[model samples]
Target: MNARFTRFALVAGTVAVTTLGPSVQAQALPACASNAICLWRFQDGTGELYTWRGGYVDLPSRFTDHVGSFRANRTGAFVDWASGKECHSVRKGDYASNYSGRFGSKIDAVGDNC
Candidate 1:
């Protein structure tokens, strides 16, 4: 693995299985084609200091309304449209829920805290 990929892996574990939505239309979008990367890092909101590496899905699932699980590191976590939160608080090696809707739905996107 290269440096970037290595770092990504350290924060976000290897993607075990990605589900392409039953609807073929959803697969045509970005992050669904290939080389989709999820990045995560700690932030001060104003500057950069205490940072944590996190993987970003950009576009996690190929299917809308689909719930998929991606591998995460010990300190890594996930937050999808389903979790109802915007931040990634998903726990690695455990079951995490997320909303695979269009752009993290506003109505039903409920992310759970870890």
Candidate 2:
């Protein structure tokens, strides 16, 4: 009976590990607080992080033209470039794992609307 219990415990432990493995390994995106936008310096949400809640915010010197990915957790926002001449909109729950090519190291500011 003791041997049988040991076998059952081992099987249960293996099952729990198997069930939880994938989720633990899938956390690639950095944490962004609710009602904010998070920008990463590299693709797949890796590297330096910048977070904004609202209003017109100019990117800091380091992040200005170096934003490589973004996750917008708010209602909406606009990304500006060339001193606001060019803009891109991102809605709530929108995210880009890699946008370096599309925006091309030209993101200047972030705010509501274009």
Candidate 3:
């Protein structure tokens, strides 16, 4: 009976450790779609996500001035069209991890030229 109890306790401990271990493990951020650019409301790819395919396009109302971080999966650029802010380049494979001040919540459009 003692040996059986010990084996059960070991198995229970292993299961608990395995279950809790992943909770603290770092999770992979969502990948930006191929041939597209992505923006996030917070840094490190957290919060809301917005994706834009190839083309000249204006950001939607919610994302007009709410982009805080970005991942340029393809070649493109983002600009603040509202206040005529300068264009911010987003080269292919570029990841702006934190846009807290520079380009933060000010992007209004995505296009080939600003």
Candidate 4:
């Protein structure tokens, strides 16, 4: 009986650890203000952050080719590449945890529209 109980407890502990592991490492999107565009250097809204709420504006030197994630909160906007070409459009409340795969690291500007 003692050996049986020990085995059951060990199996249950293993199951609980495995089930809770993923939740402990889950990532969440960072907070972005309304009517604004937020940029992050790393995926999942982590790392350096830059927020813009005005009209057409070019990204600073540091952010030109480093944007990895973004969130358009209550506003639509256009993301431009370093070659002055529109990369894509982000609608209101839209966000991307990792855009490096599709967009690459050529982001150079951002504005209300393309």
Best by lDDT: 2
Assess every candidate by TM-score: 0.24, 0.68, 0.67, 0.70
Per-residue lDDT of model 2, residues 30-75, tens digit only: 7689989999888889888999888898888888878888888885
Candidate 3 residue pairs that clash: none
Model 4 steric clash total? 0
What TM-score would you give candidate 2 relative to the actual structure? Answer: 0.68
Clashing residue pairs in candidate 4 (N, C-alpha, C atoms within 3 angstroms): none
Q: Model 4: per-residue lDDT, tens digit, 14-68?
A: 9998987766343667889878889898888988899988677888878777887
Give candidate 3 misplaced runs (Cα > 4 Å). 1-29
Q: Considering every candidate listed, which one attains the maximal TM-score?
A: 4
lDDT of 3 by residue, 11-66 (tens): 99999999877664334446999988888887778998888887888887777777
TM-score for predicted model 1 compared with the true structure: 0.24
- The lDDT for every candidate, in the order shown, is 0.31, 0.80, 0.80, 0.77
Candidate 4 deviant stretches above 4 angstroms? 1-26, 81-84
Lowest-sum lDDT 10-residue window in model 3: 21-30
lDDT of 4 at 94: 85
